[model samples]
Target: MRKITKGIAPVSFMEWVRQKPRNVDDNQWFQELYKQKRWDIVSDLSHHNAREQFYLCAYCCSEISGEGQETVNEHVEARALASHRSLDFTNIVASCKTKGQCDAHHKSQALPLTPLMDECETEFHFKISGRVEGKSARAIESIRVLNLGDNERNNKSLIEKRKQLSHNLMMANGLDPDEGLEDDELLLAVIDDLLTPTEGRLSPFAPVVANILRSWISG
Candidate 1:
């Protein structure tokens, strides 16, 4: 997953938070966001979060529309565990509401590593086979928590999907899956292009593809 550079909280959302009663708990206030139909504040929060992350799920790096059926305003530190952070803007992110992966798989479990950390991008290794492995202990746990398809047993579709996309990218660039390319400059350029988001959005699975490509030159 890519690091999410969180920016300022929405003005309206902060204003609403300030008005909350002293006795009210964060989770209660958070739910009231829906019960009260505070669409304006909720919309602002989702839009800002999604835009900053380039519309990718914070966990699996999948495409997301920010909020609605395709996305949920996910609390990075679950409200059940960290009740105090229930309304903390920095603790929240936009995650795909997929049934058995990413946010859905996460539930209230703690994430030892999260996109909020810069090391997150480097701690995981992505293979052309469409599988990922954690380079560190925390990364490993995070992978399992997010169900990022470390193997076919955990998530076959995601593995196959990543494999197909990354292989296609390699072929398009005239690189072999095993030997890669003899030209290091060209390889670096391709990696840079993949890492750079266009129109505030990266190509689907581009980060995973780029990660696999980088391994070629490093080896």
Candidate 2:
């Protein structure tokens, strides 16, 4: 997981969206507000929400089902509105989890880690067992909240990536993949690569992503 500082919505725009009263139940008010702030609501929401969803499951970071695969919009249920600040854009995010789960589980102590505010990429890394482990209590809480292991559809992707990385590393050194590096060692090497980018550091998958590639090669 990487922190995506690129293309973040402007603070002013976020402030504007945050002012809207999203928690209200008046359909007429909501309809009117939606019409009034259509551009602010739609464009920024589309971009930022999609960006958020792309990192983790829109609702739960434990999964990779981003926008288009599920209801990526950060949906707030009537019951959950009580806890929301306002209908502002800051309160919402893209989510794949059903409204029920997003509302019930997200509000609880066991919410999945979100890349938006949680920054699990800074704190967590993949283990040899294919589980995502992190340093913060919030990171661990998020793992439990989203049930990263329970979601086979999403976790399988990470597992496959790790396997490929291990294989690539072994092949690079003309050794069997079964003789892979330790998980922590691989993570440290990845960090080293991240800190040192040799080329094309400004591309979409830049310095940090390059390090991930390096780790896979050195598996």
Candidate 3:
């Protein structure tokens, strides 16, 4: 639900796309290119090739810490046919969302929601219990298709992090850390208080997640 800014494509990447033949629009062809080198086009497209690829989990938006970092996967945004048929930036999303399963579910309905598609905020909400349920059927389906709901450990870890951040914020504001609040309440309070529109920030997903938390708490 939040916008991710860290691994955003650079202007140079657009230039590279421009330099590549506009006629090179074939799904199979791009698939072969991806097979040859996973991020050949991506490297040319973005300056955030280093840390951005490794630290962020594509699905749950959890920071892949400790051993998770080693096991973390960075999936190229293109499907063979999907890429070849279209060269638009929206089609290419660097995601940690794929959870090692492929099925009819993996294929997007139409313009599958990824971090690059910012407006997805309207689709889902986070619960105070740290559960991410969809605001609609499409949102629920998207969460399932991407295996977002299956990663219980990742979600719990993020919720705990939100808790700690909330506690710290309350303490800084001269409020008791144990102010008769449940875990979700404290977390939502922190998000509502601290997160605001910041310029040139990374991780748009953070706010979306926070908003979901807020919705859950308020509800």
For candidate 2, give the lDDT.
Answer: 0.45
What's each prediction's clash count?
Answer: 0, 9, 11
Q: Alpha carbon lDDT of residue 126, candidate 3?
A: 54
Pairs of residues at least 3 apart in sequence or in different chains that clash in candidate 2:
21-87, 22-87, 58-95, 59-95, 59-96, 72-94, 72-95, 110-145, 113-142
- Residue 207 in candidate 3, Cα distance off native in Å: 2.7
Error of 2 at 145 (Å): 0.5
| Winning candidate number (TM-score) | 1
- How far in Å is the alpha carbon of 217 misplaced in model 1? 1.7
Q: In candidate 3, what are the lDDT values of residues 37-124, reduced to their tens digit? A: 6464555433243244333344554443313222222332435435543445444434432343222235534435555556556666
Per-candidate TM-scores read 0.92, 0.46, 0.54
Q: Candidate 2, residues 24-99: lDDT per residue as tens digits?
A: 5433333444567655544555556555444444433333333344434443333244344334454455555443
- lDDT, each prediction: 0.85, 0.45, 0.47
Error of 3 at 143 (Å): 0.8
Strongest candidate by lDDT: 1
**Order of models, best lDDT first:** 1, 3, 2
For model 1, how many clashes?
Answer: 0
Model 1 residue 133 lDDT? 97
